[model samples]
Target: MKDTNHPLPVIVEQAELTLAGLQTTMSLAHNTTMQLWQTFGPLKKSIHNKSNGGSYSVQCYADNFMSIPFTPETKFVKWAAVAVFNEDDIPKELEVLKIPKGKWAVFSYKGTISDFGKFAQYVYQEWLPSSGYQLDHRPHYEFMASDYLGPNHPDAQEEVWIPIV
Candidate 1:
């Protein structure tokens, strides 16, 4: 795993992502995220989007509670799919991220979806402060590195990637 304290240059590339329970029908976004932590441990994954409007937007939260529906079937489905970004590519949203190319700090966490909230807290309260990095405004994401049948799946692991200056 890459050290969270060190900065690295990343290539911005568009990546296709499929989220099983990111939709409104699902009531356990936080729970699902925690389950992911329990399964694979923890790791950071990259996300991306296209310069055009048809791309999906990526989001990271301080908590596992996602007010937005995770799927496209809902009326509030704000994103089509999650994407990982590489440096030099267009920002991963219909609207621009409004940031210049640079290095970013990466972190990894894994476990059950229910534990995701704690992991997020660690990033904001613990990791970011001690890592000597400033948070960038670029869109970050939770990459599903391992297969998770559902939010309750015991064998799920996810990697979270964030952009930092």
Candidate 2:
């Protein structure tokens, strides 16, 4: 198992996102995420000036927040987005997502993007159950810096933000 000795920090954040992506199942998330990035990637430069800060690529697991123990068939909304300063000037092709203020369990992940599932498994199955906190009702997300390499890059780094109560 990956290291779980250190305690992950919890934080609260407010975010405004401009997204172009898809709604899909966990089993299909990988392909769908790639598609979203492909569709939204080229538009990145045009949207940066209006961004709030670092770009955010997020996953909203349900229409309303739900507890854990989700299955592979669970539906979720995946987005390739950037943090926008405001909702204004959003392109017609994109959607705006506002992440409400809430507490989050933040984990620093450095590896191939495909390995995220393993880390997530560790979080939910191992760490979270023993951590004394429950998963909160909010979207989970990945914060990617402007210089972030693609998913398959060897040295890719990002933060996995899991909403927690």
Worst 10 residues of 2 by lDDT: 16-25
Please report, in order, the local distance difference test score of every candidate based on alpha carbons: 0.41, 0.69
Clashing pairs in 2: 52-83
lDDT of 2 by residue, 32-100 (tens): 666667777667656644554456777777644445556665667777778766766766667667777
Q: lDDT score, residue 6, model 1?
A: 31
TM-score of each: 0.44, 0.80
Question: Which segments of candidate 2 are over 4 A away from where they belong?
Answer: 1-7, 10-30, 63-69
> Top lDDT: which candidate number?
2
Best by TM-score: 2
Cα RMSDs, all models:
11.3, 3.4
